[model samples]
Target: MIGMLVTFTPRSGTFDRSTLEKIAGELRGPFDGMPGLRFKTFMVDEDGARARNFYVWEDEEKGRSFFTEELVEKVTGIYGAPPVIEYLDVVGFVDNSAG
Candidate 1:
């Protein structure tokens, strides 16, 4: 499995919690059934002025392919900042929902 963390730090006045919530709401459905994606979560750190997305994919190729340069540019326009993306080897996972 592969895990990806994409973090965005918007400019001080460009984003707020409400905006983030709206974005998440609009995107949730499309991502839910995406091929090769196991699960994804949109998260925020209000105090830190950051928004983060965590995604677990079936494989490294799927995870890496999703974060293309064009996607990054598009999101940078929406978030008002470029994201810092990191990929990790998922050494461990637990999904109680599966039960």
Candidate 2:
């Protein structure tokens, strides 16, 4: 499976916290269920300023799909326009994230 890591910097320091949560929440079912999609995630920068973050996509085609999907436009409405996204292959993952 192909994996992807997307990171972005928001336009400014004006991003909303709940908005980010809602965005992460909304993507759960839609993108997760798509063909070649294994998992995904994202977070705003820790400084609570710039948004340098990442998420994983399971396959190359699925990675490509995000841009082609109509949902890209929807995200801008909530998260602001044109955030930079990066794609990558997972060499490893350590999900020690506390539940």
Candidate 3:
């Protein structure tokens, strides 16, 4: 598996908790059952004025392919800032929900 972290640091007083929550709620349905996606989470640091998205994918290629230039531009427009995307090897994983 591979992990992708996308962080957004918009300017002060731009993006807020309510905006992040609304985005998350709207995107959750579309993201569910997405191809090659194992899991995804939207996180916000209200105090720090940042938002992040963590995604686990079946492979690095699938994860890398999902973050295209068009997607970045779209998200930048929505979030009011460009994101810093990072890919990482997933060394370990646990799913207690299966139990």
What lDDT tens digits, residue by residue, belong to model 2 across residues 11-96?
A: 76656667777777776676656666565666776565644445565666757666654655665565675555666667886666
Candidate 2: residue pairs that collide: 2-58
**Candidate 2 regions off by >4 Å?**
93-99
Tens digits of per-residue lDDT for model 3, 19-95:
78999998899788889899999998858478999999997788999988999999999888899999999999997
Candidate 2, run of 10 with poorest lDDT = 46-55
Clashing residue pairs, backbone N/CA/C < 3 A, model 3: none
Q: What order do candidates take by TM-score, descending?
A: 3, 1, 2
Which regions of candidate 1 fall more than 4 Å away from where they truly are?
none
Q: Give the TM-score of each candidate.
A: 0.90, 0.66, 0.92
* Candidate 3, residue 36: lDDT: 88
Q: Write the per-residue lDDT of candidate 1 for residues 14-99, one digit (tens) a residue.
A: 45788889888987897978999999999988574789999999978989999889999988987889999999999999999967
The residue-level lDDT of candidate 1 at 45 comes to 87
Kindly give the number of clashing pairs for every candidate: 0, 1, 0
- What overall lDDT goes with each candidate model? 0.88, 0.61, 0.89
Off by over 4 Å in 3: 46-48
- Quickly count the clashes in candidate 3: 0
